[model samples]
Target: MTARPILLAAALLLGACSDAPSPHDLSEEAEYFEVSDNSNNTVPVAISLRPIKLDLEIPRHHLASIAHPYKPWAKTIWDRVNLQVLLPDFQFRNTQNLAEFNSQDSADVLRYRIGGLSSDQSFVLLSVNKEYQEVDDFADVHLRAYVNRRKYGNQSEESIQARQPTMFVVNESYLRTPSEKPIVLSCNLRRCNASMVIPASNWPEADRVDFGGTQGVRIEFNYDQKYLRQWQQIHNFVLATIASYIHYPESVL
Candidate 1:
């Protein structure tokens, strides 16, 4: 998404982050490369500094699981995710996520060089909350866990990369506020959608963002078709079991 026409003021804060590095920071070393037609550099000069790579520092965030709400799943996800997912913590695997993306004098941009191009990889940058929402549904004791990548400390090593999109969302209530409408539990069927069960008490009651109060979110948790269908079952089961907490508004998202 272009990030224009942001309805919420909180979303505006995301605008502060830079898009990429400047041209001067690019590598000065001699290297033969082909320049894209778009680049202003002459064919030879551009080729000298070919590749036209860019290094982006994706800010981290967290996503709650909506698939499994059990013990070991919850605890294990909490402790181990820091290795791959980012949390609101300050130390980013030794500040590596930010450090590797050079924007100052030496490096300018980052562009992935896939070994073979079936199709230049395409990606979707989703706004964390614009698509789905959460609510209390005491049905099936659904598993929910947060992918805490948007936080501070959780960033992978430069060489290592995430196998999936770094964000996840499920529809218990599609609206920002509670309503008596059916929330669609559907997702692209063929992704991994793991869920967890988080306790209300464990939530930071003081911070609204932690419990869906005022915090603005910026992350995506991706799931495969199998996981998506699994979540659908769990979501329906929860709604049928706890008709009180969930309101399945019959509307399309």
Candidate 2:
């Protein structure tokens, strides 16, 4: 994922706190941690950098027993950030297993996977990070960097000129946003790419948004190219659904 390196670097720069609460203490809040292997005394902890609550209603059967093996920390982050609820063609299933932790930067990093349950190879990989300052500047700098790399990266002048027409470029006006800035995205004919967070090549079209000001939350998600037309709707649904789950304490507000 393109966002991994950036997230890791940011996390390293921020660093983890030595006095952070233990897994046992945090587990008392049943909604956050999942206890899977009692025999081995292995407890997967769910750490949140922000003082927010997740309010998702998931069916008991749909809740995953085992977390996705990638992060090895938590079973599931958000129960189901489902796209099917907004569109029928999107038969995606979320493998609730993922990891959450606080970086030294006082930011929380969350990674999870949602993919097609049946035959289609459609999926959305999402990453959420808490920032101390405005995230727009962070996203803009990376978006510009991606554009420059594609335009001027290691290539002959002739080859670069030849591919100029097909090269991806930023499309700031593609989506309308009344409250916040339009997500930063660059698109060619085949696929689109976002800055800061890069989705796997298999899931090409991507976009990211910063819930600016004190909200301090930045979200990036990438999905298959087939759903490119529904990018705006998909973006809105994802943002709204996730935002609904996050409730900030009065002090943070």
Candidate 3:
């Protein structure tokens, strides 16, 4: 009777307003696709990019309702999140201007991503922080969202195309620190362990070394196990983007 697979425990967050792109700067035209390796053999790592922006101060009572005492798989992944169909495309800032938008992106920051596997004319820039981090517990919401390559790269596409490694990470926790441990990603085969209840806030100066150029090496996959369904679709898209501001009704701006 083996069918159980209701695994859960993850997080995401953000904020800001009237930059004009509130509608999450809708975009489309990311054609070129190739991320089907199903692991078993395939690894190539060395990803890094620079471009940081974070202004999270979601204290609307910490958008409660995701409480977990014994882990009902995080309230069954927060009742299969829907977030009014995912926070109006992404982009925020209203909690009274979130302290002037985190003092204009510097009062503190911490963003992340570092998954790998890319080659043959690369181009992958993905973003998923529309907003969802008014923390109270989603395990304190941590992030380092990508980077998992056992070994394998330089897939000779023959004819100049070298620079394949998808890296992503942003840290600027000058305060609300949290992460004694709980940001695991273990599971190359199965036994399930796709946890991310926010708990890895390590922004050690972003471990520099970005010879800049390339806007932001975002995508290009082959991490394995179908990249754990992209870590459970980014943990149910940040639990339906914090359940769309915890069932917003009185205003979450």
The C-alpha stretches of model 2 lying farther than 4 A from their native spots are 1-13, 18-50, 59-88, 94-154, 162-179, 186-214, 240-253
Per-candidate RMSD, Å: 23.6, 15.9, 23.6
Per lDDT, the best of the predicted structures is: 2
In order, the Cα lDDT scores of the candidates are: 0.24, 0.29, 0.25
Evaluated with TM-score, which candidate comes out highest? 2
Q: Tell me how many clashing residue pairs each candidate has.
A: 55, 10, 23
Residue 64's lDDT within candidate 3 is: 16
| lDDT for each residue of candidate 1 in 1-253, tens digit (9 for 90 to 100) | 2221111111121122243443234323222222223433222111000011111111122111112111121121111111122222212222344443323421211111101001111222334443322222223333222222232355554422322222333333532211222122222323332222222232234432232222211112232333432445434432232222211121111
List TM-score per model, in order: 0.20, 0.36, 0.20
Mark the regions of model 1 whose C-alpha exceeds 4 Å error after superposition: 3-160, 170-226, 244-253
lDDT of 3 by residue, 102-188 (tens): 353331211122211111122123332321111211122332333222224664534222322123222224211122222234333
Q: How many backbone clashes does candidate 1 have?
A: 55
Error of model 2, residue 221, in angstroms: 1.6
Minimal lDDT window, size 10, model 3: 76-85
Poorest 10 consecutive residues by lDDT, candidate 2 = 4-13
